[model samples]
Target chain A: MNDPVAFVSAMKAIGAGLAMVSAIGAGIGVGIAALGGVQAMGRNPDAAPLIQTNMILGMAFAEAVAIYALAVALIIIFAA
Target chain B: MSEVETKKRRFGFKRWIVLALIALGVYTAFLGPTIFRPISPVVVLPPEGTGLEIFGFPITNTILGTLIADLVVILLGLSAYRFHKSGQIVPSGVYNFFEVIVQFLWNTVEGAAGNKWGKRIFPVVATIFLLIFVANLSKLIPGYESFGQIKELHHGVGYAPVKLFTIGSLNVYTIDKGQPVEAGHADEEHAASDDKSAAYSVAAYAEGGDELCHSCEVVPFLRGAATDLNFPLALAISTVFLVQVFGVWALGPAYFEKFFQIRALVRGGILGSVNFVVGLLELILEFAKVLSFSFRLFGNIFAGTLLLSILGALTAVLIPVGLYFFEIFFGIIQAYVFFLLATMFISIALVSHHAEEHH
Candidate 1:
């Protein structure tokens, strides 16, 4: 038969790319979150630091979703 | 007003000003760790471990890093002390730098421990924090995680090989050049020394890779400390035991009455069987304290380390930089949580039994 290695490698590439699609949610979510935080900072400059700290915390929490997605994708691509 | 009252007012006013300054310091630290709190790595191990070691243990760059970091911090502290004597105006530069860390850790420990006991634990917690925090943050530096090797080792070399698992623990032979070239060892000199051939055949972790981080590839470092699971587990066991120890210390032999509910039995006399049973349940819960302390710290930090690895495998860009902020927050929280719970455990141990003490 033709090289199965070529086929498996192609599947992983596709899977890795697809797995990274999970970042879209994170990207959109983080962008919107940043916009919200920036707006709040504009309204209250004093509150900006606390708000930003919380924002990063929120973003980290949100980023965990992307991490979860990446993990799923990684398991697909890397694991036998 | 009396002289004492006037003096008290002055002191209180100064205290408030100091508090504001501290508030500013903390705010800056949270928003911008770069300005104030950047940690560096330490190298512990030396270079002579042949591609494969004559001894059973594996030696790597992290070992070297840990030792160097320890040496620098300890030596720097000693040097700072000698340079700045008892109450000249103030110390500057690295002396000032260390003074700030001392202050930060002092507050962190005291905040967690409360005034009395906090002072005692401050040095231990603060030292560990300074060391680990510096070590952790240093991982961000260009060469910190990048010094490790990527070698394809001969998996099964004959002599005295274990029979069981084919995959050796030292599967990836990292010629770990863990330390930066010392002041004494010039770069050219290092390169020249075939004698101290630090096998630093390192691998570059590209943007977006695999399960673990290329830098921290969860395989295991040569120098594992109490921060490791075994250490943490021992900490957990001791802490939980310490809780009981302190509890007994605070309450005396009667503290066991907490477990037995002899007080409740005495009050209820014949009809206290249900309450007695409930007391036994509380005893069981105390045992779970060990599990809580161990797993909570291990899980969070271990996961934090894992997450960073994955992040490295992903985009090596502005994104991972953001996660550095997240890791700082996560690191502080985990450290504080460990300290706080330990404090609470100790507090529980230390607290005097109101009813019995009065009686």
Candidate 2:
């Protein structure tokens, strides 16, 4: 409590941890995307390749949110 | 019956080999004096200086890694070219390997974009994938992020360096997992007096005995190229730049309309104003694309390298092997993701907004 330096470091650590909570949204988004893709593929197996490709694209977009969170977390830890 | 017997025999032999390997791995994990007690990897965000200068510019380890990846790509290209130039009807070896990858990528691109546009985009997207794939996978090579020059540690916490061996005049050193030398009273005094602004002490080195060499840490000669933000940022910038170029080349002056929909705002009333706002958002999203692309690749590979190092430091044997295989799969998937995204972006840019409205 006395050391301002330690207190700032602790705050940065906590901030970084909080930043990563955004990844939960990304995880759920990706899972839902996959679920839809799988069902579509099952319903129409012939369109599976196209569906798979689009599915991956959707997943990547979903995952980008988490990547942003990771970037923020990293910046908080290392640069801030 | 004979064919079935042969299949069973082969399966039995493979299973025994796998079992023996597992047993050997377990034994090494448990019994062997841990040869690779990697000093809780110093997670230096910025690439470490190699102390080598080219015309006074300091060379960083990530630059070295980038060069290595470039060299590998060049070699692969040359080898594949040589094999092709041989005019062999059926390709073998390296050319065959590249052929499968190229064919698969080409098909995907063609499927997404028409054949004409796919041809134009394929080379750029494929090259990015190959380069990123090489860079990501190169980190798994034995010496990377491990072997390096020993330097005096400037921080509070650092591992003690053990002299591995000597060759002629140079002494090889590696960090031992023994007691880490803490920041001494001198460092604390330095921190308290001179460097109150910074959280950590800016002291030159920690105090330690000659035998332990606790003040030393290794600055690795090569790190994963993508681990550095600059590499991915450079790639993302160029990719985005190329997307704009492709857009302009395909749509001429109409490409700018995608970003600025002034005509829509002037004529279409409420809906036109909405279109203008949407266009502005699209323009903003282009910039966001760069951030997402670079960060996605960098975060994945950097996290992967960190995971492997931490896991290796923790459990030096069987566990890391599984993780290494996982990393390999993850690396390829990341490379594919990057390629797929670039292809999609370029393909999207090729289409006019008006064309999409009609469809």
User: Tens digits of per-residue lDDT for model 2 on B3-113?
Assistant: 999999999999999888877766655555443444567787888888789999989999999999999888888878898688778888877887888898899899988
| C-alpha lDDT (0 to 100) for residue B177 of candidate 2 | 55
What fraction of correct interface contacts does each candidate retain?
0.00, 0.82
lDDT by residue for model 1 (B4-56), tens:
99999999999999778766655543443332321222221122231343366
The DockQ scores of all candidates, in the order shown, are 0.05, 0.82
- For candidate 2, the per-residue lDDT at B229 reads 93
lDDT of each: 0.53, 0.84
Question: Which structure among the candidates has the greatest lDDT?
Answer: 2
Minimum summed lDDT over a 10-residue window in model 2 chain B is located at B202-211
Which stretches of candidate 2 lie above 4 Å from their native place?
A: B1-36, B183-213
Clashing pairs in 2: none
Interface Cα RMSD, each model: 8.3, 0.7
